[model samples]
Target: MNKKLFLLLLTVCAFQFSFAQKNLLTDFPKGYTPEEVGKRLAYRFLEGKHMLHGGKWISYPETFNWNGALQFAAKTNDKELVKLLQDRFEPLFSTEKALLPIKNHVDLNMFGSLPLTLYQITKEKRYYELGMPYADTQWEVPEQAKPAQKDWSKKGYSWQTRLWIDDMYMITIVQTQAFKVTRELKYLDRAAKEMVLYLDELQRPNGLFYHAPDVPFYWGRGNGWMAAGMTELLRCLPKDHQDRPRIMQGYQTMMKSLKNYQMPGGMWNQLIDEKDYWAETSGSAMFTYAFITGVKHGWLDAKEYAPAARKAWMALVSYINDKGDVTEVCVGTNKKNDKQYYYDRPRHVGDYHGQAPYLWCTSALLEKDTK
Candidate 1:
């Protein structure tokens, strides 16, 4: 063999071997299988304090993240996962006050969603009984605090009546879960009505929803809440229901807009339409879940959108560190019109916002892969 050709071949082999060593497929989390990745995330949550948005473990909103874990548990029927959920909530079962942080805040009623789900899975009366009042009181119109008609002034309604995009999930998921447990149509009706009302008020011509009617910023997680909330409701909502078509249209349209905004690396910007804003984990996971859901339901084209979901999932997992911490998550944000505010918001590793969506996306991927 010629000396020049032999040297060139030796150099190429050495470079290839170095590349393999750097990016060994095995080095990327041992289980890329959605179920395994999902379990790793859940175990991380269990090992840490459940605090995400606030310090309170048993409250209205933050518990929603826990509830996502519970949903994943129910989907998999894993005994260890189920035990983790039961152990977390079993202490709160001793007193209604312990279970409910605020007696009358409808937002707080969202905490009941998990209990109802637990009741369905475990047949425990305490879980069912605990959740019933919140489901019943979720929609009672409160007397205006000072007889002024502003949404913030109302007690039970808190931002519920204002059609904020965040309320899309905050209100609907609990109500829909109530319907699932009791087989009552009213719970479903109220959830559906509120979703349509919000979409009507806030959905922009581009198909993405504004953070709120007054706030024009297309915040990533706010739109995430809207997309995930609609997907949740449609899971149990009846096919022939009067509002189904409209809700379907809104979901598909928002998905189209979301597809447009996804960055080449598979994550979305903190302010979704802003090119220079940072790619965020929570929003990216949510979109991946929504895309997987759309493809499963026949609302999206599998050929075109599945690769997008796969890409987003790949990007999302890159945020998970060796200890299972999901990084690059924008912390709980309020609606701000300033683009700088959204971009400047703090990002945290293992923030509950990122953890919950990472679990959700993994669960969705697992279910899709099995089919």
Candidate 2:
């Protein structure tokens, strides 16, 4: 390591690591337990009507929240909850078929993840049959694809590759689910290659990501998407896979920045480096999920990161209201060069954007039997 760089990392690591010595993490005091919080949020999501884009198609945030709920339900063996989630999806095959998002854009295409989860739980052929197309069509250039989209496919990337930071998660999850079900390399391979390109193009010297090429600001949720996306992909990436090294490197690099940027209040801001901005729960939860998974998987030094992850979870719980909605969640945002644009993004409650990652953190904190 470079002398100055080693000194800088050491200083940051020492500051982040100071915390309680006993248990590291233990049973939650009350409602904060993964079983408690996870079920509450999952049920809260169930209580809502099907959320759609343009009130016509199931929205990506809803799909993302649904996937998190499914994973949590499976991990906790909540068969009753699973039935509710499946019952909700039944409409899509019939009365709500028109509401199923088409595989055109990255956001809409990720809706396939919901049925794929259903397939994993129910082993229904229709679920698998319904879900795989979204993953396949991402790389299968359509007649509607723009010339640049076609060019991307010709170069072995998704037609939907717009180099947006958010695409990291949208493209990764559905394909990861496909790989999980079919044990196929192509799906995972496509995601890995795409991730490396995004890392090369977007990741900055400080290990944070710019939202887009022209939009050079670091929006919290944008980085959240990348953090959780990389964690998800790297977990499933085989040890010897060609892209693992680079992906893992990117993940670790980003995590160090996350640790350094984390607020003393155990949260992160809407603009991560803008410490005075309001603490954003959605991004905070996403980073907590990543840190928890990293520590548990031995991808990070437990002593160095476990305390930070644990503190983040405790802080996150403080933001959840009695109704189970996490407060102060930065609503869905677009990239902009103006710093104030990020600072002024609306803070919403119970938005699936916020709800999804809380469930993911619940699942990560509770994971024991699975690796």
Candidate of highest lDDT: 2
lDDT of 2 by residue, 74-136 (tens): 999999999999998888899889999988999899988888989998899999999999999
The alpha-carbon RMSD values of the candidates against the true structure, listed in the order shown, are 9.2, 6.0
lDDT of 2: 0.89
In model 1, how large is the Cα lDDT of residue 296?
A: 64
Per-residue lDDT tens digits of candidate 1, residues 83-197?
Answer: 9778866667565344355434545667678778788888888888887766676665455423432443243333346567877887787788789888999888888887888
Q: What is candidate 2's CA lDDT for residue 251? A: 98
Which parts of model 2 are misplaced by more than 4 Å? 1-22, 369-371
> What TM-score quantifies how close candidate 1 is to the native fold?
0.85
Number of backbone collisions per candidate: 0, 0
TM-score of each: 0.85, 0.93
